[model samples]
Target: MTFEFTADDQLYQLAIVLVAGIIGGELVSRVHLPKVTGWICTGILLRGLEPYHASFSGLTTSAVSSFAPYMSFVLGYIAFTVGAALHFASLRNSGKRLGFLLVGEALVTPIVVMAVMYFIGGWLKPDEMTLRTSLILAAIGIAAAPGTTVLVVQETRARGILTRTLVAAVALIDMVAVGVFVFATAYLTGLGDASADWHEHWQHALVSVAIEFGAAFLVGTAAALIALGLTRTIVGPAFLGPTMVAVILGAWGAAVGFGYSGILACTFAGIMVSNIRHDTVRATGAYLHSIGGVLFAAFYTFAGMKLDFSLVLEAAALVGLYFLSRFVGKYVGAFAAMSLADVPTRVRNTLGLALLPHGGVAVGLILLVQENVHLQDIADTVTTVGLAALAINQLLGPSGTRFALTQAGEKGKDLPRLLDFLDEQHISVDVTGKNKEEVVRCLAAQLYATASRPSLPQEEFIQRVFEREQAASTCLSQGLMVPHAILDEGEAMTGILGISSEGLDLPTPDGRPVHAVLLLATPDTDRKRHLEVLAAFARTITRDLNLREQLYHARSAAHAYDVLHAEESEEFNYFIEDALTRAGAFSENKT
Candidate 1:
């Protein structure tokens, strides 16, 4: 039977796409590959079957192409969300380590890829070998897939220095890649014209690109302010999602109309809102993340539908070369850079492996290259090589990232239970203190006395705790306070729990007097773990009213420890199991 498509049929087409994408994501997730790989494979399968089955045609090329505008919207949204990682506080905390790594990887990746590609091209296809072609390919190689990296990090809930650095690096890499591509494109355009004034053309192209970037920045900044303003008046996902969508789409449209970068514009807007209105950005991000899985499935499926197997097969050699070169470049460059920058050994070893995924931005760059008049002669070859490399990398990159995280000891590890660090000797049910400083001093003395090897004198430790409290009140709302510090000579994390029956005058966000105080001290190296422990305490005590009451009203230290341990056991198990499943270990065991 012949299939007659109509505008109304688009809904049915969308349903099929969603279902197929979901199935594909689920299938691959079970087998230990990234869900994105499966989504793309589903699209490829549907497209390949189209010739044999006429009905399949509707769900493949034509149907997917119809959703291009929607796909672009999703891409812009993903880019914007990724930009949230560029928060100033995070950068300030990370400091020079992150900056050095970003510069090193960004420079090394393009240089290595270009050199390898140039040599390979000269040997295999001398006609296609040109400095301009090599530079364009290198520029494309500079883009690491932030979307994939972010998704995988979220999936595993990986937290550590390496993970933080990876996120920051990915964000910086894209910006660098855009800048490189702009300059490289201008240079290529000048090269294409031998008789024309090269310097004049270069100057003109650079000015035009700069104008496009400026327009994008202005549009993005305006959209961010508007979105922040809307958050004050609008509440809930029902209003919030659509409102933000309108803002993002408007920015995207403006970028397109002005011949600017929509991805850059959306990303800048995301960064602005995230830093300026953190709560609003977080709420919106949570909503986006909830719906993003389906959108991503659709996007990758569409990407797969466009895959030309014939082109992949013909360009197999070039694709293999490009893939290996890029892989080696990222690994060596990241490792060397981190080492030279005095990053921890564990981080330097595993970070490069996690930086392997390449999608979205790279594909976007290739499309940009394809549309340029000066680059049309090499567009087909470039696209073919890119698709093949992407296909391999998308399938393999996430697994490599998972392995790196697992090896770094960040994956499959939950925050330590309160009882894990607190023992009978470390708990004080009756604490006599008149103020916050006195309570903190009591806890610090208890912690220092209990430490296996007290790194600092008791008075010195108390002074440090007071200094930390002055910097920021650890007292959270709902009668809880976590006084924490890191000492230079400290080797292991130590905790002492103190409860005041009458409560102390501790400043808290909710202005509630603090009854329970957990003092944490760790070595300077375990900052990530220190934060995790603090978060675990806050998350557990704040949510469970009964548990908090039990601890607060406990007559003895033993009773309080029991209550805390019981609550921690349940929460820790759930997170640990989820982390294992995400790392693919649980599935492997079942198999």
Candidate 2:
């Protein structure tokens, strides 16, 4: 028996691509590399195999080429999601320093890259070097891979000023890159036509640019409105995924039909939706996240399939130059920008490193150059150098981003264990209280008595804890309650762990009697530390049912403390050390 396949069978091709991508992603994730890198690598491997085996002939290449339209939709969706990071409310809270840093990096990166590339272009390819080509290279170099940055941020569960600033800056960088590319393309067109009237050419270029931007904005706005309306009327949660897909497709089709940027259009739509119809955006976000994984895998896999090994080899010198120049430019520009903005030392030092990923947006810009008839003379050179540099950046970018996040101390760490924050005086085995207020008050009294100087009034402290409980119950599932409040003049965090043998009548969501109650009092100025303590407690007790039971059955406070200490992780120790240092309670012996 003989089996055969035809190029027209796109479903078969898609299945093969998705399966390969899934396997590759899993493999790379195991090694701590970005899943996107793995998907791209899989595509490249499949492409490489085409020449050796007749069975593999044209499948990878043909599938990628045929899937071009769908890829555009995926790109638009990615851009839109990225745009949501630019929520105005979030931006306002980020302050003017963040804005300055973003502008500084966006402007400096391209200029630095352009200057370096201009000087090196002569040696790399003197015959092809031209002012127009150099300008194009610089414009394309402005884009950084938001997808990779987002993936790393999500994987690490990073949260802090640095993470917020990095995300916002990435959104702004791509927007600025698109604007720069448009203007550069116009200038390049005028350069190619010296005989044409300068004023007329410029006027036409300006008009064309305006039309593209206007059309894109209009398309985005329309799509957003439709999606928002659908979300309001749609009852089933399952429809949300299809609704987002439809909106992305519509925006992409309109942008393509009108000779506009699908990315810009979808991004604008996302921004509008996020800001104006926030509920709709939030509802769709979960659905999009689930579906987006497979789409991104397929999109990147196809991107890898298009990689030209021969072009990469031919343009090796130019590619290396581009990589080095862009890398230096991003770091220097981010550092200088942050310094000028007077950003925190951690942000200034790490933001540049985090922004190293460069590919998706740059690839889109280069594709524009390749498809433009007016730039045909320099298209081959641009594509070869651009793709080669992009390949290198994609391979190395995620690691750089992860390193920066880790070093900045924003990546999720094991917080100080609940027991680590308490001592013999602060732990009570028999916490007797009839209600939530009495239980919380009892814990707070224990913490106050243990303090070196109990300057804070007992009544006032109890009142604040009640205020926090009123705002939101801290009761968690698995019989745990972590109530926390800020101390007015506290120098450090004080914790009290109380285990109740008989369940308290605390109104927990699960309605299970609370077996363990951990109360924390943190310095009013240190909101981050307070959250860290609560998070640590929630993570520990909720995940381990047996541990909760062990605490409930402990004969004494010391035994309960031992149970938690035994579960201490390296991350938790680091968190405790850092917290203690901030609280002025750390000593050399603790290490």
Candidate 3:
């Protein structure tokens, strides 16, 4: 259906999705699986079955389905973001040892899986198909879920040679798999008579990929320029959002609406925006991760809508066989690929387990080939890939990725770079607990050579802050907080952010939940430095809501510290100063 929407519907849908996806994504994702997985599950539970899955049906599904088209648009954009960023340098810098592991697993895993698929196909339908279909199906079956892989890695907060290289290999090869499928699909559609025409489709598709990639980059560049020029009171999130909409809606309209390849266009936009050295683009990305919550939620819900339960039962054999084939194929293929490249056994086993989760591309490819007249088997294969993928990938994907990182001894890794820097400098910052304490600690740390531990416990701090601020009114209301103590000499004008997923009891100046706590305290003498830091931090925090949101959910002290230091590094003081300061302090008791 056309997405020509009314103003109220637009507003309503937007509100629903944001509430469902962003706010809900955090809570449910932790309880269930990946954030994306949780979003889709939430969507389906709310939207898929009628009579509302109970009384609160409106709360769950009603909004999800209404915005399905926009969800498609957003997924097309996000999927591109997740898929498009493959580079040789990124992979290389990530590590050679990990690269060896991924390649090794990918190689060996496929061979084993394909052999099994061939046996299964031979047993089930020998006369109906040729050996080639079995082989192709077997190979296709081996395809790993790149999106799931990506989601899992992102969720684990892991970054390293192994993670980066694995993603690169998947992105690099999936297109080749698609090319092979197009050929196989063309042959299958000829009803056992394969044609060279399949080769032609790849040429067309690739040429399109090239042109679209280029054009989309230009489009994104122009878009970023326009965004950079904007200093109008637009919240930073609002700025990147409109820009993203322009990219997805303007160019993608021609593709998805016209039944052309919007996927390539979306991928191009995300790449150009992400790769460009511009603050607005980064601002836009931060906005995207936070603001597009609803669109993502709706997109997943609609994906659930596509599942045909009646058909699923009847085609159970194809379903079971396809998934079984895929599982075997991917596990072995990924392991072999990693092994041949001389990867470590520890990494190899992790990579093998890590490789099985699948999502976005498999679904897109399935959609691309679903309508062919002579491609019944191919259609069956597509269903096997998409549905089976949804099933298996969703279940083990996030957990497996988390397991991989933990096994590698990389738990609680930080995505924000600023926190790590502050850590090395020994900047004592309180990141655990409620927001106000963090804020107090941050400011307190900045002022003195000697660091003081946070005296207030999280709950007590939350209670006190709530007495002053009120419940759910996050200190992040204006995007920054500067709480100057009534006293002048005790703590050097402290500057720190309190943070928590379980929001503080502090009443917000604004009704939104508070996540980051920025405490600003200073002596009357250091007025200049206090105001200077305040102005800089406040301007940045106010502009980027997503930053506040991300910080609010940070699980570690390092991550919370990084949130502020990234934009304003000069303001943080996280260490013990020279020896004289401590020695001189003895005068207080001696006097």
Candidate 4:
């Protein structure tokens, strides 16, 4: 049956696209592949829906564009999170190394790509070749897909120096991309105008550059400051997510409306909030973390759909040259930079590969080219080559990132697991209580007494725990309760686990009495770590029946600890040995 695709049919198409993307991601992940590749692959399949039904011919195109608002939001969200990683204290020690590496890669990559493209075009396709095309293409080449790189890093749970440096570098490189593109466009415009004075043209170009960046910075900073004020004063829990989302969207919209970059503005806002609100960083991240998955799935699936295979064949030579030159340029530049900085061998080798993914930013730049009056002559050629290169990069980039992080021994170190802070000394037996408040007080007193050199005094710690419980019930389903507090100072996460034979009368979703209570204390700065540790505990108890039963019926503190760390529970513990070593090595090199 011939079907005419229209706006009304988009919701149905969206449902199908999301499901296909999920299934594709699941299947790919099962085979030890990047789930992102699966989503993209499914998107590519969805793009060819015409084969299934002739009426579906324009469905993917219209549906994808119709969801533009969502795509922009997700990109901004991803950029914000990536920017959050740039904590001042964390980057201070290795700032020199990062600076050297960024300058090397950012400066060298474009030069190599432009030179190669220029020479290759002259030899192979002189009629289509121009310095303007080469310059514009190289300007677009500077950005590695922050979304893809961040997704892979998060997916593998990689941490340590390489991961941090790669994330920070990607964020900075995109900014470099914006600057380089602006100047190239400005100068090219001046070059196109034969009667324009060089001195006057330079002044105008500088003004344009300053305004483009200045407006974005002002918008982002203003948005962050406003959000910070509201979040600090607003005591309601429900207000956090919406408040932050609205502020980010405002920054994005304001920047875009001013004829600048929304992504850059979002990045600036994230950096502002991250550096300024160290204590509330976790709360800020939690909102994004909660909604990130579905949004990412939708964004990536649409990314895959945008890949037109027809363009690859149409400009085979240009695509081949563009992809190869860009790859070689990034790798070589990164290696040279790392060598000069005397970084770890593993990181030096793998860092470039980690930065290979290309997406949204480059596509935006190419679109800019298409819209420019003077650059219109070669816009189609640039777009075709640029997009085809991006398509190839997306397919190969995630795997490269996973491999790079793995080789650097930085996988699975992003967050602490539950067992990392639990041991025999901290797990208590015969935890006694009559009611929920009593139970919380009992756990708090026990944990504080047992803690070795705690930052907070015994009474203060107990009071903090009580205040947390007062704010929100720590009770969970399956007769478990987790009470946590953020301290002003802490070297690491410290906590106590209590097992009660006689259940305490606590509020729970399942209306069961509390048999187990895990009290946690982390420094205010380590909020994300606090959340992840809580997640680990919930996941363990909810998934393992035998382990939970063993912990409840344990004979002593030792037995309880054993139950928590048994062979079955090993999967829940995420700390790996070499991750620490790599982190130390990274520091040693910096020193």
Q: Write the per-residue lDDT of candidate 2 for residues 1-591, one digit (tens) a residue.
A: 997776557876877788888899899999987788898888788788876642643475655778878788777777777887777644533546567766765678788878777777765678775666777888888887777788778877775557778887787788778887887788668767778887867776777677777888899989988887877786456776668667788888888788788888988888878777555566667877777677878887887888765566887888888888888888888888777765556778888888888867898899899889999988987888888988888778878888898887667733443334564446777887988888988877777655322357878878888898899888888788888777776466677788887878778888798988888778878777677666766766777566667778775554554455442433342455566676575455566
- Mark the regions of model 3 whose C-alpha exceeds 4 Å error after superposition: 1-32, 43-48, 51-68, 83-90, 94-114, 125-151, 166-170, 186-241, 254-260, 273-281, 308-312, 340-345, 377-381, 384-386, 415-591
The window of 10 residues in a row where model 3 has the poorest summed lDDT is 418-427
Model 3 clashes, total count: 58
Ranking by lDDT: 4, 2, 1, 3
Q: Best candidate, TM-score-wise?
A: 4
lDDT of 1 by residue, 166-278 (tens): 88778778877887788888877887677778777778678866876788889988998887777777655456666667767988888878888888888888788777866
lDDT by residue for model 3 (61-96), tens: 334456656755765665455444542222322334
The per-model lDDT (C-alpha) reads 0.75, 0.75, 0.50, 0.79
Tell me how far the alpha carbon of residue 507 in candidate 1 is from the true structure, in angstroms, after superposition.
25
Which residue pairs clash within candidate 4? none
Q: Which runs in model 1 stand beyond 4 Å of their true positions?
A: 1-8, 192-209, 233-238, 413-591
Model 4, range 258-370, lDDT digits (tens) per residue?
88899889989888888887545567677778767788787889888888867889889989899988988888888888777665567788888888889888888888999
Specify the highest-lDDT model's number.
4
After the best TM-score superposition of candidate 3, give how far the Cα of residue 529 lies from its true spot, in angstroms.
20
In model 1, the worst 10-residue window by lDDT is 412-421
Arrange candidates, best TM-score first: 4, 1, 2, 3
lDDT of 1: 0.75
**Model 2 global lDDT (CA atoms, 0 to 1):** 0.75
Candidate 4 runs further than 4 Å off: 1-7, 51-58, 235-238, 415-591
